[model samples]
Target: MSFHFEYPRTIAARRPGEFKPAAPKFHVRWQAPVTTIVSDYIAVQRQASDMAAERAFFQRMRRAFDSAYGPDSFEEMRQTDEAGMVNSIVVAYWTDIVRYALWKHVDSFNAWFRSTEREQEAVGYWRETLTVPYDRMETIFSEPYYHAGLARTRQAALEPMYTAGYFGAMRDRLPISAIDPLNSPYGETTPEGNYAGGPVRRVRVDVPPNVVSIRSGQVWQKAEGEQLDDYYQNLQPKLETGMAYLKEHPETTGYLSLRAIVHLDKDGQELRETSKHGYFLALAQLERWAAEHKSHLDIFKHALAMRRKYGADRQVVTWHEVFVLGTTPSLEYINCHPGTGLLRFANVWGNPPPSN
Candidate 1:
């Protein structure tokens, strides 16, 4: 017999009036000249066997992050997989690129990378540094009362643009060639694309004493021919359904704090694989949700069944990482819409209230 479990209404849902809009305006901002350090630490060798070593590597990096940038730096949310894996990412933002360059050359930072013992460990590391100038980027916060991402920089806000709809909309302002080269591997023809617009979706659920905030990021890739058709027709709907399911059933899905779906884009620069990352309140909560949630299990089984029918070559998960992180209290937000980025966590993280 099939089992159906009913979930109670979450606190936020019960008292919708109490969860008032902190910031209703859409604030726009340009990316300033800053250094962004992207690091991926993976347990590639003994991925399944060396759990202890994988954890140790994470702890070592956490200590390094605390000692180096601490609270002053803009640290984005760390992403991790729901399916257990010893793969994680740490993204640190620095307003002064020069300082970051100098710190890399310092003895302590230099020694950590060069240590033979660390090099031979089961984990593998990859790093990239990007110096983004003011015009090269753009950011928007639908609810300005909460701060996060570039909002932590305290940059000034400009009026929002109708064209500024999605995560990569700013890429449109860049030279078209930067996105799709004339001599492309996918083909010489431009690929079909779609962008979902409007404000970032924020779902706040209050489970009595504990209140959880859920945010989303949608990163789409250009695809050609049948692949593109399948993405829009088949995969896209399923994804939308999943998102709706979470929104409708917050009591069961409350454990999920963040969900980002990134499509593979090897032909273009950066992020080469298609993957999903979900952040939970804690590792224990994630484990329990993964094991007990019926909707989650159905989706997991559907993915496996699809892979079996389509074959592994047709569906490849190149690489995935999962990270559990604590909130950085020292981060700053200036003239930002109160509802941006990690600022959504201000109340939960013990930060001061947003100044309208």
Candidate 2:
């Protein structure tokens, strides 16, 4: 039987509302008793000025991403960044850091990254990687049929979850928060023109500890007719607007950076899926935005309506994997545009929130 209301949680978990959820919810079950999983967000990007060259540059690097020592599973995604530059991203996953490290050693990736070739006239490249322990992460889904992110890691199952659609729900889902607040020592304060939007090559932002990141995705390749129409016509617009708001107003929203990507297959086939990769200073701030922000609420309202409309026939699938980073931080920007990835927040580590 599904343990929807009886899932394990600590004191951090929130009490449910008088009304049950509008629909069933689920979470990823690890293949075995594991402690950590490696999540790597690697991007090969370029400004309009270097578009053709960057695409050629990125194609040459594909072999490295698909190496024998590469991640257990991964996804190829594309996006046009806020700056109007285009980015091709590889969302790679490894059950452990050792294998990923091996891949790095075996592949020409590190060599190319450190080479002088990346120092050309135009900019393009960045990575935001995290090694999350089991206790520091939470995985939830709207349906048992579709899965992504860590679910591709040979998961045991997608079991029913108890707490969701409520403020503080993600915190309770993470076992560490039961005792520790998982607060970041820093805030999302980017001094305008200091470097955030300026020209900079080879930048590295030391991401603060306990910083939170989430990969929320939507898959609708299976939808047909009305369900498909609803997702694109109504639900998608809400999501786009919300993500744009977060990307543009990170300082106020506590979002360090947001990347909205369209999924693609290895063969360059575009898939009917999208993902939002958002980095925040703390989980509390993320919760605050989700619970109170108009942008997010709009998305929530439309999604709920779609769920109600389709009922069991709902072909749209949504899921997310949220985690708080530990002390070991690994983020880098190489010959990248000033606004690429977390490059905007480059070199701002452990500083108190910039004076209001």
- Per model, state how many residue pairs clash: 18, 0
True lDDT of residue 174, candidate 2: 82
How well does model 2 score by local distance difference test? 0.75
For model 1, the stretches where C-alpha displacement exceeds 4 angstroms are 1-55, 67-84, 154-161, 165-169, 172-356
The all-Cα superposition gives candidate 1 an RMSD in Å to the true structure of: 22.3
Backbone-clash count (model 1): 18
Across 82-126, the per-residue lDDT of candidate 2 in tens digits comes to 779878777778876777789878788778776767767465687
Top model by lDDT, which number?
Answer: 2
User: Which candidate ranks first by TM-score, i.e. highest?
Assistant: 2
Candidate 2: residue pairs that collide = none
Please list the Cα RMSD from the true structure of every candidate, rounded to 1 decimal place.
22.3, 4.8
lDDT of 2 at 235: 78
